[model samples]
Target: MKYEFIKSHEYLFPIEKMCKVLKVGCSSYFKWKSRPISKQLLLKEKIKQEIISIYFASKQRYGSPRITFELNVLGYKISRITVAKYMKEFGLRSKLSKKFKVTTNSKHSYLVVENVLDRNFEAKEPSKVWVSDITYIHTKEGFLYLTTIIDLYDRKIIGWSLNNGMSTKETSIAAWKMAVRNRKFDKGLIFHSDRGVQYANRKFAKMVESYGVIRSMSRKGNCWDNAVAESFFKSLKTELIYGNKLIKKEKMELVYVFKRKWTFS
Candidate 1:
């Protein structure tokens, strides 16, 4: 290991000095350097490059397990332990998830329905149950409010809208329209959200009622009723928006594109 270290840094420091500092003999270091690189060493180098590629491709959101799965999919025959070791050696780590602040304001006089879905996040078929929520992204100009409707069956973002304000029209209604356009609304389909004013407002409720959809609101002051939506926001903030300045719509658009690719790929 000392000789390998000396060889790796030889271009930056004198070999004799490194050998002296590491308490190794110059002759042994030279002899070790003259030997051909072993097959294991060559394989490790190749795996290192591949790990870096996969890490960046995931935007640094993939840890050892996912990276190991990707490597196996590519016929690399690598294990999670090896991937984790390499990641540790290279100081590569997945982005840590931060706690996201809830943006729901359930104090309105608007009517709210009981939790008919009742924390049953599972959906038997596509369009059977949908979850919606709003989150904000900070930019130089101001905050950009994002509203998303996800199909619970597949956990896909069926529709979304981005705006500078969190009004009912801009938030819930817009996202609902997009979701309606994208998927067939089954009769008695359940649309779930927190008792935020956007989702509780009579206008939005009537709009959803027009499509024969059942309205379900989270219990007052509780987020777990709509946990799926909150989890999606956490992933978005951790993987895309946290610790980054998104000043332009183009960047947000690019993020959306990457999100779709990551979700489907």
Candidate 2:
């Protein structure tokens, strides 16, 4: 039979109290507790810690399979199944993607500007042409609407905004402000976008006009006209937005993500 001892009993009758409570002698308990850890046990503990460190460093994207491969690359010889068992013990798993849809209001009476871009996304320099568009991302909360303006020359996203609702003010004005803050605009600099109400809105157009930038818009129902913006949205959605789970939609979300994405470039 197994027995447990209490500290209160230790002060009562010494060995007699311990033997009565524990049903084992204090000397035997001390000998067992004082035994040094085996070499094999120490090695196993070290390996377990190493595996845990690697698992967390991967940002939880890697399950045991990928972790096993990564460990091998790092000069660790371990079985794939063993890694899987470790990951399961640690509760590590990959994220799953959710479905998202586009929300561009093309059906409006707003005057569509000419397709000045003409599928020529390249620019000689920044501010010569800026392509803007809005894309949607799915998050656990709901749909996250993203608006971005990219420099045609460098394909760099100069400005962006993220919000829970698709409002005109939510898309263009915030991005325009960011762009103006980043770089000075010159006369004849073309600001191109699709015929969405956000771009065609009088307030947005006036803002662009104030900068002396030409307002260029895609033709009705034709996405190819604003191909630069379209392509940027496609790449962004494919590479980043689609894979990320939207926990909360905030203005600074895209800014933070883009900063990291650009760093990797």
Candidate 3:
């Protein structure tokens, strides 16, 4: 206690004077200060810092296994078990997104194509054409719906929403609002999507039309009409959602993470 007090107030008062007042030997305090930190402790601290660095660098997306692999790649002699221990010590964890029990619920036989993009995926410029789609993600808790609006020119997700339901308000309208907020568009900008109920209903169409946006829907039987959105979801499944399960995460955080990745990728 005496040594601790002296160290705590060393900057504010002379160390020797504090030691003298506390009836402790100055030499004892000096000896403690001069002792070298153990090599193991030093190495432990270095590993801890590295763990923290990699955790946040991935937006908490990497778990112990990945972090351990990264450390080994960087020449750190560590094991996955040890990494997990330190992760627990620091209260670090990766967010999860799991479960695939269902598919999108857009099974109305509406063979409507207001303006057939006709597989013309190319966009002359940004905001001139935007494509939208929804895909399911499996979670231990339940299924999740990820709706995205991508500017075809850049193939970037300009707007997105993560939801537990496929309602128009939760899916298409929410995503379109975000897309408009994220990018400027003029009248007659073509907004293309599958003929899902969320995008087919009057509510969603009215929302898009209010902004002077043109609507385009995929044909009755062809999946290639909105290939841009389909391709994005396919890649997402193979790359991020195939084998490993993402621990369940908050819906909002998932949407934000998706937006950040596609916005800059």
Candidate 4:
């Protein structure tokens, strides 16, 4: 209870000092500390381990609130504050959100397609409606550009390509190849995307003609016109990109690793 003892073993001695200050004995304090760790402690450790595993496994996308909720679902009794402390100790952190600017250059004279989608995301058949979009990923090397085409009906990512240069060939070829691999050519099937140069280029237009598919583009400077593709990108950033906790050299490096991984769960 003396200041000398308080400074000797600061953390461990504090509890005993507190008990003594409250008129409790060292024998009772020892008894309490000596008692077997509760099942709750064991459970908390388990939850902590699982949380660390999930947090790192997800490349650091999860933070305390999400990790706490996950532990609760796994039958662990713990608070968010506890998870936050454990995360802090382990150097676990959530991903930093960066600003995303729209890179669509619709100022050119290229003809844009009509909005055939009309915000109808549903598809009766697999290849009936395909939505595509492009986004930029940051890296220490440089900006890495990405294009993805999705099957609206099955919610499957059918086609994707990554490149340093954002070109029409980069996107169209990726989408065309994916669509070709999946189903027979269906004339009048809609291929929707924003009115980026890649989608509106004459070469891309010709490629769409070669496939007998109709090209539909979002209106200029309109976010809602290509809502499906926009929403897909948003979810991708939210769940996979922005939510990650890892501080890698570049976003593309992590993205490349993630793309190759298959999450069965």
Which candidate gets the maximum TM-score versus the true structure?
A: 1
Give the distance in Å from residue 196's predicted Cα in candidate 1 to where it truly belongs. 1.4
Q: Candidate 4, TM-score vs. the true structure? A: 0.61
Per-residue CA lDDT of model 2 for 1-265, tens digit only, reads 2322433344665655666566777677656556887888676666677778875665545556666777889777789888878667677665434564767787878677788878887788778998899988766666778788888778887887777777778889988888888777779998888888898878888878987898888777888887777766665564565445544555476668767875311
**Model 1, CA-based lDDT:** 0.84
| Worst window of 10 by summed lDDT in candidate 4 | 256-265
Clash pairs detected, candidate 4: 60-244, 60-245, 61-243, 61-244, 61-245, 168-198
Question: Tens digits of per-residue lDDT for model 3 on 140-223?
Answer: 687788898988888888888888887889889898888888899899898888777888777777777798887888776567
Q: Which candidate wins on lDDT?
A: 1
**Residue 158 CA displacement from its true place in model 1, Å:** 2.3
| Pairs with backbone N, CA or C atoms under 3 Å apart (clashes), candidate 3 | 96-246, 96-247, 97-246, 98-138, 98-139, 99-138, 99-139, 100-138
Judged by whole-model lDDT over C-alpha atoms, candidate 2 comes out at: 0.73
* Residues 52-165 of candidate 1: C-alpha lDDT, one tens digit per residue: 999988788877987898888988888899999999999999886453445688888989898999999998889999999998876655567888999999999888888877
RMSD of each: 4.8, 12.9, 14.0, 6.8
Q: What TM-score against the true fold does each predicted structure earn?
A: 0.68, 0.59, 0.58, 0.61
TM-score of the candidate numbered 2?
A: 0.59
**Model 1 per-residue lDDT at 129:** 96
Q: What TM-score, to 2 decimals, does candidate 3 have? A: 0.58
